[model samples]
Target: MAGTLTVWKFDSPTGADTAITTLEDLQKQELITVLDAAVVSWPADKKKPKTHQLNNVTGAGALGGTFWGLLFGILFFIPLIGAAVGAAVGALTGAMTDVGIDNDFIAQVKDKVTPGTSALFVLTTDATIDRVHEEFRGQSAELISTNLSHEQESQLREVFAD
Candidate 1:
């Protein structure tokens, strides 16, 4: 069905929270997707900050914890095939924990978020973009959507496209 899609990019967590609350309130009348996302923030005047590690396995103690859990699981059911199953589980868990820039489009945004420039993206369908924008006009967020002019629609399509 034809519906409106509204996107708002917030500057920080506070702005994101406010937008999320507003969108959720509107959800009583429409559908919304407040995707949970995070980016490194840094001061623009200073040099850019490096990407912080997000690997759950490689990080200190995380892999060890995974292995420890597997060991416990295996020991608890020694007579059964728990050892082999637990080993497989632990290996799969560790392999899945690698944090790589899987999506090129999102990676661009990841690279831009410095030590003080986080962004939160909220997408809502069949909602009034103007109402949402008016509610969050003062905050450091820009509302971009196809609800605007043809040019804006095309721009938004490209930005949100695969």
Candidate 2:
């Protein structure tokens, strides 16, 4: 099955990490399959969030470091560069579009995930949506799907091919 890039934002700094336990449980239950997973935890006192790849669940399908680094860097770092480097910003935008992500999605994530907030970034497939949703009914998480375009899919394949 084709993988979907999805993110879920939680109110607390530890929320995303806490959710990982549940995610592992669900995966074992055969309710969902994960390609790769990572957690972003941002404490109130921190300047920025920290990331950790879930290596145990990540098998052959994993996109690993480069994919997540570029994405999180775009979401959390690029803005600091601002228009001073207009060409770089434009190139960054182009790079994002090459992976089938748009400005709207980037803006949305930037808006929702802030200091004291945590997010779970997941590349997943074969999920029983209803069951998964039911399991997560307790926490308030904003779900965002990248919904990779055909072009994005092709680019991702090329990225993994190397």
Candidate 3:
């Protein structure tokens, strides 16, 4: 059997709304289970009463900023190796901010999500990755990253099957 893995990366929580709706529709057509939902939200608010249950999994700004820094450095320096070390160091400094965990930026972000910067990852593995991709052809969401192929998905499904 073959399977597919599609990562629907979104800038906001609602970005996956369409995908979720599509999943619901797909569920109507066939049996499907959500393998995982990655959400970046405020840690304290995530556990509060009356809060949405799914937003518990959170991402942090400082970490994301750091990631952006590192990515920017590598991407920028790729074509300009003459500036690699300088760019990398610059990226690291630009990531720091006042009033957060010092030297533990990632930990701080994990403990307290920064404002206005986060991501949600919806990982769906089904025998029908193509259909899912078709369902998400054009939308406002950005494809931040992805991993998987037909053969790999099949192997993964078997390894993680019910």
Give the worst 10-residue stretch by lDDT in candidate 3. 49-58
Model 2 agreement with the true structure over 1-162: per-residue lDDT tens digits:
566788999999989987888889889999998878888888989887898778877665467676677678778876676778878657756866777678888888889889999999888778888898887778888797786655676677566442
lDDT ranking from best to worst? 2, 3, 1
**Candidate 2: where is the Cα deviation over 4 Å?**
81-89, 149-151, 160-162
- Using lDDT as the measure, the top candidate is 2
Error of 3 at 127 (Å): 4.0
Q: Candidates sorted by TM-score, descending order?
A: 2, 1, 3
Sliding window of 10 residues with minimal summed lDDT for model 1: 50-59
Candidate 3 on 1-162: residue-level lDDT in tens?
222223344444445554556656665666444444444432323432111213222122112333333332332233355664776555443432221113343333333323333433443445365665576677544444344455454444343343
Model 2 misses residue 141 by how many Å?
1.8
lDDT of each: 0.38, 0.80, 0.40
TM-score of 3: 0.36
lDDT of 1 by residue, 1-162 (tens): 222323344555345445545555655555333221222334446454222221221224212333323322322223355565776655543432222111342334434443445443332234465675676677777643323334433443343233
TM-score of each: 0.36, 0.86, 0.36
Which residue pairs overlap in candidate 2's backbone?
A: none
lDDT-superior candidate, 1 or 2: 2
- CA RMSD, predictions in order: 15.6, 2.4, 13.5
